[model samples]
Target: MAGGAAHRRPLAGALAALAALSACSLFVGVGALSPRMLLDEPDAVALMLASRLPRTLAVLLAGSGLAIAGLVMQTMARNRFVEPSTAGTMQGAALGILLVTILAPGASILAKAAAATATALATTSLFLAMIHRLPPTQPFLVPLFGLVYGGVIGAGVTYVAWQADLLQLIEIWLNGEFSGVLRGRYELLWLTAACVALTWWVADRLTIMSLGREASVGLGVDYAGMLRVGLVIVSGVSALTVVVVGAIPFVGLVVPALVSRLAGDNLRSTIPLVGLCGAMLVLVCDMAGRLLRYPYEIPVGTVLGVVGALAFLAILHAGPRHG
Candidate 1:
């Protein structure tokens, strides 16, 4: 009982801080709508509800989904340095998108999203299998290999785009952006919320799998089934995020990391907290982008890329004790 109380206190504090962050996210933007307008003007209300609201929601979903994806990847791979982006998953999807543009210029958005996601999942699975065969003495080798693989894919995409005279278009797809997100186009991001819920429902199995294949099998858990399901979830979240918001990089790596530090890594215990942390991190970055530019807009992806990189390096320097 006392232990529960001790845990609850810090947890409550973190939740409160997170809620405050969410509220701050609401007032962020360069538009004419002020806090007073949020309450006073109909036009302001419409703009707030239509543009900023959806954008905020999109940021939240992308951040939380990416963060959770990172958590799952780290736990499953038993490597703190590995993330979906670093593991060549997102890069593969980006390469897939470039291919689609070359081969099927008229492909529907749905078709492109599906193809990119399928390719990402397949590549991730292949990378993992290859990692399993590598010498165990070099534990970090696989993630490095994944990075090299992603770089190669990214280079290929860039080269193709240059040759095809679509470099500018490809550049837009390469970096993530949230400035253009509005009510209709941004709702697709809500799919990430659904993904988060699914993760919660399967939290127990994931927890079991995190202990390792031998331990999971000893406990009668179907390791292969659980793994395949997790991979699908990762691919869907990564691809959908890219499709909607253009590929915000480090949300996945940083959010889960911060949550794991504060709340511990138990699936059920840390899920919502991790999600909230992700939302807050992205929200803060998005707001910074909006406020710093005034009339002009900076992409949330760019801000996150800079911020997430710093945060990730900090985590790496902090070492694995917290994780």
Candidate 2:
């Protein structure tokens, strides 16, 4: 009972913080939104419904999805640093988007997302294959190789976009801003909500797979099948996020690591907290971006990239002993 109480307190605190930040997100934009206006002004009602609500929802959904993706990657790779960006999934999605823009300029949003998902799956599979070849004693090599792989892919994307004169569109997709997310523009993020639900459903199987292939197979788990499922989930979530809000780096890496620190690695219990913390982090970053320049807005991706980098460094310094 005492241990349970201790666990509940942090979970409760995280949820509370998430709630507060979400509320602030709804009210902190450039628009003049106030309690009084929400009740009295029709334009305010429309604005709140059309822009504020959707932006807030998008942040929450994207944050949760990315964080969960990170957890899934770490589990599959058996490496803490192997999040979407580090694992080349984001670059794969970027490459897919660039390809579609170049090949089918008039492609629908769904088609673009499909292309991105396919590329993300392929890239993630390559990462897994590379990791399999490396000695397990050198865990750091996996992420280092992933970074190089992703960098190469990113460079290719840049070259292609430059040649095609689609650099500006790719820039917007890479920067990951939520300022332009109105209702219709952001509804695709709802797909991430379904992805999160699917993650919850498979949480137990993933936890088993994290014990390594030999151990998982010994336990009668379908190791190969589960790996494919995990990759699909990670690819779908990463691709959808890139499609909807661009790539918000480190949410996946940082949030899951933090949740594991607090709650241990029983993912069934911790995934919810991971999702909540991820949502809170992004909401806080998004709110900070809105307020930083008063009238002008900074992109959430830029803010989180700086903040997440610092946090990532700290996590590295702390080492696994602390975690």
Candidate 3:
């Protein structure tokens, strides 16, 4: 009972902090809709509804969803260094988006996202299949192979985009930013959030899944089914984020890895923390992007790229720890 209470306290505090950040996010744009103006000014209400609220929500959903995907990838692969970006998921999604642009220039965002999701799933499945063959004793090999594989897939995407005259268009999906997010535009991210939430229901099964297939079956877990579910969740989340706000790289890798250090890998207990921590980290990065250049803004992906790289190096310096 005491242990549960202790855990709840940190979650509570994190939630409170997120609430504060969300409020701050509401007022951070160049248009400057102050809290005082919101009480009486009609334009403030319009700005809040049309722009601020949606951007905040998109940021929250993307951050949390990416983190959850990363955790699921780590669990399934039993590797700390793998996530959507490192595992070919994002590259696959980008290819899908490019092909859709070439084949269906007038496609809706939903169609593009659908295509991206399908390709992302295929690529992630391919990566997993390749990783599964490597000796489990050599943990470093999984992420290394994943990196090489993702690079090959990414190269294919780049070459095809160049051939099709879609390099500029592809560039938009390559780096994630939320400046254009509006109420109607960013709603699809809710689907990603939903997929992540669903994982909580089967958290125990996933925990057992990390033990590998034969062992998972011995422990009464349906390893193949869970792996499929994880892949779908990871691919869907990655594709949706790419489609909606471009790719928020490394949120998945950075957040889950750090959270596991504190909360350990019991998904039931750590899932909430992982999501909250990810949201917080991303919100901070988004705000920094807005503030660092003042009126001008940087992409959240660019901000996170630098930050994630540093964090990635730090994590590596700390040495690889099993999830």
RMSD per prediction, one decimal? 2.5, 1.8, 1.5
Clashes of each: 2, 0, 0
Looking at model 2, the pairs that clash are none
lDDT of 1 at 303: 93
Give per-residue CA lDDT, model 1, range 1-323, as digits (tens). Answer: 12256456766776787677767766776667678886788989998888877887788788888888887877777666677888878877777777788899999777778877898898788777867776656655766787897788778878888898888776666688888888898776777788888888888888888888999999999999988888887888888877777877888888777777776667877777777777777778887887787767788888988998998889878876622
lDDT of prediction 2: 0.87
**Over the stretch 247-270, how does candidate 3's per-residue lDDT look in tens digits?**
888889988898888777888888
Off-target runs (Cα >4 Å) in candidate 1 are: 1-7, 321-323
Instruction: Give all TM-scores, in the order shown.
Output: 0.91, 0.96, 0.97
State the number of backbone clashes in model 2: 0
Q: Between prediction 1 and prediction 3, which has the larger lDDT?
A: 3
Off by over 4 Å in 3: 1-3
What residue pairs clash in candidate 3, if any at all?
A: none
- State the lDDT at 189 in candidate 3: 95
The digit string of per-residue lDDT tens for model 2 on 1-323 reads 12366577888988888888888778887778987898899999999999999999999999988999899999898888779998899989988988998899999989989999999999999989987898787767877898899899888899999999989888877778898898899887888888889888888888889887899989899999999988888999889888888988999999998788767777788888888888888888998898999889999999999999999998887776622
